[model samples]
Target: MSLDPINLAAFLGMALVTYLTRIAGLALVGRLDLSPRAQAAFDAIPPAVLIAVIAPSALATGWPERVAALVCGLAAMRLPLLGVVAVGVATVVALRMVA
Candidate 1:
């Protein structure tokens, strides 16, 4: 529960790697020609990766938090993304307060 040099270093390292990979891909993407089917699949990868990264953390936090996030995510899908996140955060805070 403390911010330390080691944690910061690790975070920076991961961020650097992520940034480089994304930048490299963006730079190289136009140089290659992907088939229509492959392009469609590639387009979906970002969301899939996001879900894979978020799902575990959301689930590990417990049912209440997960439910809040789902409702928020749905709302975000329908409304603004920021609004959905706010609603989900509010839900979690309210639940925690009541409990």
Candidate 2:
């Protein structure tokens, strides 16, 4: 029994799905007029996705890391968004390396 090939296949499947989704979305969106409700939902998706991804990762860490991530997220809301991500990732990496 082996897991490496299964992991690789799983990763490739996800990558393929992600690529197809993006390509299909781009191909379809411009040609169709989305309903007003759908457009509103689409507008909401970016922030929803950002919060969904960041909230869990930021909250799942230890107290110190969570505090750091919270502060970084607040600071990120003020700076270019990438700064916040950089701060969070760098802090975690540094903590991991030193510990």
Candidate 3:
């Protein structure tokens, strides 16, 4: 199959813009001096975003997901990010099996 020239150019343009934006962010962040609290908040963004994305889907279904999300929310307090994720996955699996 032949590649369409316009599609290829559009893809390349998008890739270049994305790469430049990422590079600009890295440079900007490196130059900034943020407070400890701000740093912590920045670090927390990923997990917060992950939960925001996952929560709607989790809550949309039946009782299993609701219960699993509750367990995961508790686990997030004491556990690290990966551990919290593991707990959530395990809770969902076990609950799905039993229900």
The C-alpha lDDT values of all candidates are 0.80, 0.78, 0.95
Count of steric clashes across candidates, in order: 0, 0, 0
Instruction: Say which candidate scores most in lDDT.
Output: 3
- TM-score per prediction, in order, is 0.54, 0.54, 0.78
Strongest candidate by TM-score = 3
10-88: candidate 1 lDDT, tens digit per residue: 9999999999999999999989899999998997786577668777888898777788768766885676545666787
Off by over 4 Å in 1: 1-20, 72-98
Worst 10 residues of 1 by lDDT: 76-85
Better of 1 and 2 by lDDT: 1
lDDT of 3 by residue, 11-55 (tens): 999999999998998999999999999999999998989999999
Number of backbone clashes in candidate 1: 0
**Relative to the unseen true structure, what is the Cα RMSD of model 2?**
4.6
76 Cα displacement, candidate 2 (Å): 2.9
Report the C-alpha lDDT of model 2 over 1-99, residue by residue, as the tens digit: 667988999999999999999999999999989899999898778757887877787688666577667777677678665676677777777776666
Q: Give me candidate 2's TM-score against the actual structure.
A: 0.54
What's model 2's lDDT at 52?
85
Model 2 clash pairs are: none
